[model samples]
Target: MDKRRTLTESALLLLVSLFVMISQGFAAQQVIYLLTAVFLMGIGFLLPKSVNWILILSTMPLCYWWPDIAYYLPPLLRILSMPTKRFEAATFFVYSATLLLLPLSAYQGIIVMLLAISLYLRQNDRAMTTLGQDFLASTDDHWEKQQQLALQNKQLLDSHETQLALQIAEERNRIARDIHDNVGHLLSRALLQIGALETINQEPVLEEPLAQLKQTVDTGMDHIRLSVHDLHADSLSFAEAFQNLLMIEHLCPVEIQGSLFTDLTDKQHNCLSMVIKEALTNTLKHSQATLLTFHFKTLPAFYRLQIRNNGIITNEQYPPKTGIGLQTIQQRIRLINGQVHIAQTDTHFQLTITIPKEPTK
Candidate 1:
């Protein structure tokens, strides 16, 4: 495109020079006009966009020395200016050159107008091309940012799902341990006692019923063992489980202190797990908290768990109304013979639970 534009400008310069030579019919005057016009045109073409103003300045000499034919120079100057500046330059040249050339010939006035219009339109086209490139660049940047945000959201969701699954698996294992350790042990002991009773008995009538009872006890113990094995398929430490729960990004910062794990009855573990899950859910759904803390420890014959959060309390009054979730939590604690206390203030909510290391029969 640049090469074509150069060729076109050179051709126009040649045509204008030939016309001036024919019209003036003076060799010296023709040589002066031709050289001045060619020099200005060459400077305009050579200067980069950075030095376009120099090209504009070059036009003054043409206007002064060759006032009669100065209208030919503005079109040549248009080549050096950038797209955004082209329109203004074209307008200036048209008005300035017309003042000098308009009275000389009606033909000259028409030619100058035609050239100005062509320059203005070409500059406008260049401006549009530049604007289109900028628009495309902005759109591409926005698309890349959107893609990055979508990928982050997907990763967050995957992490949340993995944490919830781990919680479920841990709960299952605890259940299996409870059944095997409590029920299986009791049944096996009963079967042994029945066998000892059989050896002491001397009656044939008592032997049949004793054998039947032993078979039932043996079967129950076997089933309990199998179920316990199935439940123990996956086990996660308490510290790791807590870490996963805290992986939820938008939630407040969580701090877990004291012992993360210890030996506790299945019932106590289940109660504590339930409370933690419910507390986290409530915090996410209703509480606008900035910090949460969990403190777990062993106190003599009791296992103690304390949870506190710096979230807005729904009610200002003491002894707040109990929802079904809280009622459920209380009921679970009662079943394990544990003590639960929930307290709330304007800026904080707290839950404290204490269960016996060995749950009641």
Candidate 2:
């Protein structure tokens, strides 16, 4: 039984017992009996569950056999609300004997039995209610813990992926540097040697072959340079690039929110980086902005970028008549089959970009 409900029931029973004693013309012994019943109830509610049956059995006979003290029986029986499974058979025998040996008439005995049954049912209901509340509280706690654990696991997985990507980028940069320093220098030296040999050869027949050799070395050097450039460009980290771009002095406070956990292709990264740089430059140069916001989101099939500022375009040249910057942004997005939306209101200017995962046409 819940402590508060047990206390409430016990207090109400005490009041009833006192009323009965007072109406019957208070006797010293009857007052003593009422006090003893209240004491036993307090102890029963406070004591451990294992020994509660002892208190229940002790108080029952006192209330049952004593004349005019039956008013205290309900409170004494409240102990039955607790689970006393081990002493179930013993309590059953005790109740049966007490009812059979009652000193009252048959009708009074029937009424008393009915009263006892009703009190047991009511207390049992209270017990069930208390049990249900506890179960709900425990279940809620379990669910909250499960949600927290799932969030932590996702964060851990994302961190691991980010670190792995960084490591791969670093390795690519190292390889690019090595190729530029060693293989590129060797190719350049080979081309120079072929040129020198061509200059010394005077025979007309050998001139054509030497020229072909020089062309082959030149082609090899060009291939190496292109390979090195591609490696360096592909290895650039979008996050680092964004941070570096934002490091420039700004007239307004910039708030960057949200992140894209999905991996982006090199072309997508370059496009976004360039678009953001242009937007920031325009905002700083043209608009009298107090706050700028950069927001990113990843959808099921697209990546979204939003650059918004709380600034008004007052100058006629703010969004130039030709709209060259906007056109360039559109062209870049079109290459990736993405969408760009530019909105200007009295209070704000917003640029929205949505890049689809798969090309449309």
> Best-fitting candidate, measured by TM-score?
1
Give all TM-scores, in the order shown.
Answer: 0.48, 0.43
Tens-digit per-residue lDDT, 1-361, candidate 1: 2446544755564565357435645566656766766666667667666676665665555566566446455445444545455445654665456445444454455445545654664565566767888888999999999987885675556445444554575678768768877888899889989999899989999999999999989888888877776686334445565667677667788888798655654445555666678778777766778898888887878878888888875543313335545655665676667888988888788888888878432
| Candidate 2 global lDDT | 0.70
The segments of candidate 2 whose C-alpha lies over 4 angstroms from its true place after superposition are 17-28, 60-65, 79-82, 85-100, 104-118, 121-130, 133-141, 144-152, 155-167, 170-361
Give the best candidate by lDDT.
2
Error at 169, model 1, angstroms = 2.2
Considering summed lDDT, which 10 consecutive residues are worst modelled in model 1?
Answer: 315-324
lDDT of 2 by residue, 137-156 (tens): 99999999998898667655
Q: Cα lDDT for residue 283, model 2?
A: 81
lDDT of each: 0.65, 0.70
